[model samples]
Target: MSANLLPSPMSDPIEFNNSIDLSDIGGTLTLAETTHDAWLPPEPVNTFEWLCENMHSHKGAPFNPVQFPWTKGICEAWDDPRTRNIWVKMGSRLGKTEVSLGCHACAQRHDPNTGMIGASTQRLLEKTIGDRFYGMMAKTPALADLCPPKHRQNSHKVSTRTFITYGAWSGSPTTLGDIDPKYVNLLEVSKWVREQKSESDSIELALARGSEIPDRKFLGESTPTIKGACRITKFVERASNEYFHVPCPHCNHHQRLRRNTTGERKDGGLMWDGGPEEAISPEKAYQTAHYVCESCHKNIDETQRRSMIQKGVWCGTGQRVDKNGELVGKPANGIRERSFNLSRMYGWTFTFADYARAYIESLSLSGQSFANDWEGEAWVPLKVEMEWEQLAKRLCVGDWELGQVPEGCYFLTCAVDVQVDHFVCATFGWDNRQRGCLIRHGTVDTWDQVREWIQRPYEALDGGSDMRARMTLIDSRDGNRKDEIINFCRSVNDEAGPHVYPSMGGNHGSMNLRFFRKLAIDADNEIGKKAKRNIVPGIHLIMINTTVFQEWMDNVMVNRVPGDDMSMMLPQCLIEDQDLFDQLLNEKLNKEKGIWEHIDTLVPNDMRDVFRYGRCAAEVLTNGNWARIPKHRPRQLPESEADRHQRQRRTAEQLNRNRESGGKPNQSKKRFVRRPSSTSSKRFVRRKSL
Candidate 1:
């Protein structure tokens, strides 16, 4: 949809676009002629005549002349005889409310005798779909004109009514089953699916209600959350080609897009801006180039993608032709699906300004109220400053995998967390020989800094042998930084000399509390139990174990001075010859109590966690006696006499058996009865072997 097509503040629909041939978009009948007489009552040529000029009885509202074009498109889809279901997948601020509101208006207009249902995950529904759309009938004069006099007895119908009828309107996710409706509008179907079917739930019941209505239409709409979780993903998978296929520019190939197919490039990269430049265009040109056809292997371009796709109709490989002169598939009586990003709907014209504006718009007071009503349905909150920083930090460190390598050379991992505006990264280096028993660490706030640290390790290590280096873990925790990490790793991996391996390592990475503790304990006992499992034994490496390292860290904490505030620990720790503490204090403000009221509190970074964990592993692996000894028990197990007696008994029995049988005896089954032999001074009597 172009900016020109945006819904105006006024309620009237824009001019009819007869210029658009429904044939191109695959509509069965141009909106006017498609619906059966049962669905669409004959258009009232003169409203005064239809109601006998009774203006006072109806909500005292005159019909608005212009029609809502967006609503018309949506309603047309709803009324289409071939469409059993429709899924509207969109993003924020694209006039989606009108689509639902218009459908409601149309449904009410068709059958004052029939009931229609609008549902959301919660009665509040994640977004303002129900609230906004329900309000539209009263707020928008055009929609108000469609309601029967009985449905709106007074001007304040929405306020007084429990339903969108003559009765009071009471809408709730819980009450959907009470008032059975003809047309069911399930907002955020995917969310409803998730909640209702969370564990051992019967979500299929909710999803299946519309199908039970004799010839009911089900409309589902939502902005995608995760890839597979969205109801739209399922819809798109089964949607007809006429409804989804977009044309390629050069060869005129039609491509049906689902989750993975849309905007894909021939070189196994994204056709959009974020992916790698294809072989055809390395200059970073935004224009669509030759697209190898997914079906025919023919080359295509942007022009073709537009020409082959139809907006409203569906198609398939060998399905029968519909009345619209396009290949059509079975009308899905069940769930019909379609999904596209808000950017794609707007012709992919998103700019940073647009993103920022959206970010801000979502935070306004009204937006916050709306969000709360929708169960805080916003995927990314606009008031995400703290969250953004946290995300940035996580992104910087999510997938950084560290390993103990060999020699003086160590493997280093670095990553940057990205937020709306800032990024942070921590770097880790491990010795290869001791399987990351020893680790060196650093932290930087930028990708360039990480790159520098990754490259600089070569200078610190001696000889060309150091060039062999172990794995270099990286945090690709954030989706935004996946390309950044992948590209960085690719470049580093491509370089000569030391190999840089990129693995995901973070607080949530494979290196957990247990691994860290093991690392710490392994430091003293080089051949400790933990080392036997994950680490190659007897290698020299620098790896921090988390458990023992945490113990070491507990000693590092400084209490505030007596009669001092809790805001003075950082500077004290920093000034106390701890480089890590100094770095942390410098990075943040002092906020601890006691004598160190003026000093900053030392906090753990991604590196700190890694260091501690590595230390634990090291302590455990190097000195099992010291590291493995439980603090409370603190003792070794002594072998009991029973162990020696059992060994001796087994050996003597074997020798006696061998002597009796001349070292070979055939197995035999025999039954024997023995009488207890009495001994003068013994707890038991021994019997000789027969």
Candidate 2:
């Protein structure tokens, strides 16, 4: 062989013969043997290299990792044995579907286990499996050669919902429960709708299909939708949230890429040269666009992108610190879900200029689109309506304690919301100028506890004078406690300083209408009336337009102008509680329903409701007259009839003057009016004014 090897081109090719004896030259391989070994293809060590060697695009070109370096970590996570569930919350056109297809191909080739892939709908299911998955298998020679003769003979079998050769099935979430697979891939999970009567959620149902298998794998990828409702976001929150961190070319400081609207230096957000207004014309914006290095404040051109990405790594931010403040690292002891988040800002296929143009164009079109597509963030509806930080700015350093009433407070009102286990009360003090302060807010275990707390005198912060809530409104919406609330209000006699009223919220069409409407007498007996009149005779039920008051609260909290009468003031102590602020801001206007509702159903807005009820109580007690009321003086004990008669004459004259000044006999122009004692009124004789 050594004599003839150099001369014979016609001899059987030695490279193709696997039976050639090379064991004699195996020790560190001789130079000629090393040269011969180089001719054979090296086995791929990882899934990414396997994909590159085997998978191909629709055009029959082998997969290129250089084009999308961001996928390296994603592929590594998929192959990682420690990572049981993988979630990718990413922007559109980032090759998520291709990665999923590669995973499917890998599962089919290596393990040969049953697997499943799901789309949002059946039509999408058919298109993905038939066009994308099949196209990849047909175009790639390695994957195509692995197909059995039956799969090659009948192409229809490979295109259908059930591809038996690969032991894989494809369907929508609604139909995924029937199949039992070891591997599961959910595509565009945000678009998967919940079945009306299904016991399990769409994601749960899909996961259940693979529950019997010990070596199960789950992968979910989607462009996120509404914040709370987004499945992908929820998964990312539970997983080891990993972000691709690339080093700054100039400073070498690593950071995740973010699009910045505010021109702050430390935020590490993507910065542009011009203002948002200049970005109105996308083409012009694209011409001048470049990413600013977060650490060095230097300009990063598109030319440096490839090098920066090559050195990038995925940093897990989901780790928690131990008691000693040490990093916990990846969650190896738990369920081991690994999540990856990416945006178009880091994509190589699209230039930074293209990202700027797309973001700028989307700003005028839809804010949701800009958030979901460009920023790769969840879509949050009506973000401008109420912001916790904006409301926090309304905090004032008033000279008042938590429960003490301020100097200008003329009247006090308490609003109570009844929950299953506790009553949430918000006590507010209002001045004649319509300025208000949160006197106190807390939870009481029972209605009796709430009544006792409400009746207790609250001392004035400025002076030592005492004040009590003039009116308390208890929400009677809970059917279980409605009767209890009504009975309690009825039993509280008029002698009590604070008169309790049962309040029920109503959703009327108009916002400018009366804040509270008294339930009509025998309203339930009327032909067209749907209002209930089952309360005790003395107890009055007030129908409150809660939506209007919520809007008012929102306006006062957000668009408040200094010195405006409608502007509200929060004490420094209460405003510092971020939990309270979040509770108040958790609700948003449902434009379609024309009402204010909680953005997330789990977040309680009891504080917001209490505040609304307190405002309503203020309006009802004052009878829309918020003008300053004259402070009452202490009544002098008359020593003689002459003095008493003189006092009566003065009182009659004052009454006549008040009547002539366009004031109703019972109504006061001020928010708080002092009334004469019933004993003094019965004893004194009213004489004509002289």
Candidate 3:
């Protein structure tokens, strides 16, 4: 045998040197000819290929890639070194759990690294990992070989809390800490409890566990729930946001699929034979459903969706490159998460008719369920809620400054909110029609500064009048400063000046219906004793039902049609202030709880609360009515011809008497009085002797 037949030292140095026997065959045979040739392993397959080969469905069917073609890119992205974090926001029954389990199986087969898998609840964890995942392993021959003898003997041996290969835990933010893993899979993140005793959320805690590893990977999948509270929604917003763009079969124009409720037939969206306004049964709507091409006025039927999906591609809308032009997901500064958002519209597994049926069925149900389950989108409770852009568009543009009141304002109302370090105030002006304009808003550190602000009168733009706030409401919720606020209100409230009232906001179920109420002073209290001595009366606190007020404000902001009776105007000065706009739109209503709450507690909503307080003060000044009072009494119409003649004759007689008396009316003379035209002629007749 030649020397070339022998295994090179570079190929297998230890084997070539130690296992070779010169006396057997002059040491010319290769390692294949040696005894250990059968021990060599086969070449490794990629993650996607492995999944296609080894993943099985619950019905004992092999995984099919053609059914869910959109998942191909996701599985490939998981294996790509450029991508670390993969977040998928999709509708239900899209094979998210199956694909995730396939990736886990691939990891266990190839790398066998310690990892973590979590679900929103313990029951979900058991169903997904304990049943479905283990069943898949048992059905697939290749995957079954990788499982331990204990798991093979009994599937229940694989605990949900600590599964095979690594730790698997359930529960929310509480169970997410004190573990380091290379791979982390979080399922249904939207259902995870957001509020935790500690500072970090479940997602944050899970991400921190893989911080020390260089090639750590995380997968987050969920159907969005609330508008701003959904974890997957926020995750996709911060990640490389990608949408699936498909080609129109007729025009071949690429566009993302969207539900068209715009009511216009020509506009491109998901349209049916009859528009949304035309009421039809859910079954009929499903049969007639078709997609309208955005570019051309062509209809795409359900039969053509499969072909379109085959040619579909993901288009990234988020920033892929950093400011330094470096590619995202580089391991240096930590992995840049890649995110994908796909709705049920583009999914080939379900027909367009199925989606339309689901939508129609959801109409009879709640909007949130329809949005999350059918539309695969986040649900916003108030559809017409005020957004920053809408508020910005309503800004009054002119030469007006921040603190200057507009020309048409007749009265002003001020609201003060006490903070730990400062006092924030928002002052609004009202015209005769109750149209509101934000006059000024600012923060001051000292109470003296707040007093100076309240005392100074604001001059109108036209210089027609200078006026102070008609009513001021100070927030008394801060227990630390309640006494101070009450004392200040007591000192400032006067008959001749603007009435200052300490205000406390109540919950939704509070019995208080009136906007403002005077709290009953305790007869045995010190303040009541002082009031008895005529020193000072106890402060009147304005008790406001915050939920009711929030609902009213939401209605005013949302349902106020153009040229309507009510209008809320913001000054141009506030258009550029993003912080104020955020504060104004910060609160969200929880439909399930029937209450309003801020999205994030850490964010300062002082401007929002102050605006609410100011609105309450305005309501108080108007006697809980939004309309302004008329300036003059209206003229009465004549009841008959005789009444008209009598009124004319009386007017002429008065003019003649004034002229005869040298342009002066009679000082003391007996005259027959007649009632106005509204009453009978003889009803008010009386004789008086003078």
Candidate 3 Cα RMSD (Å): 20.9
Give lDDT for model 1.
Answer: 0.36
All candidates in order of TM-score, best leading? 3, 2, 1
Residues 140-174, candidate 3: write the lDDT tens digits: 88777654454343322243222343333434544
Tell me how far the alpha carbon of residue 290 in candidate 2 is from the true structure, in angstroms, after superposition: 2.5
How does each model score on TM-score?
0.36, 0.48, 0.49
Model 1 reaches what TM-score against the true structure?
0.36
Error of 2 at 157 (Å): 7.1
Mark the regions of model 1 whose C-alpha exceeds 4 Å error after superposition: 1-77, 80-84, 88-98, 113-131, 138-140, 145-173, 193-205, 208-212, 225-243, 246-254, 257-313, 316-325, 328-690
Q: After superposition, how far is residue 651 of candidate 3 from its true place, in Å?
A: 75
Residue 600 in model 1: shift from native, Å?
34
- Which of the predicted structures, 1 or 2, would earn the higher TM-score when compared with the native? 2
lDDT at 198, model 1: 39
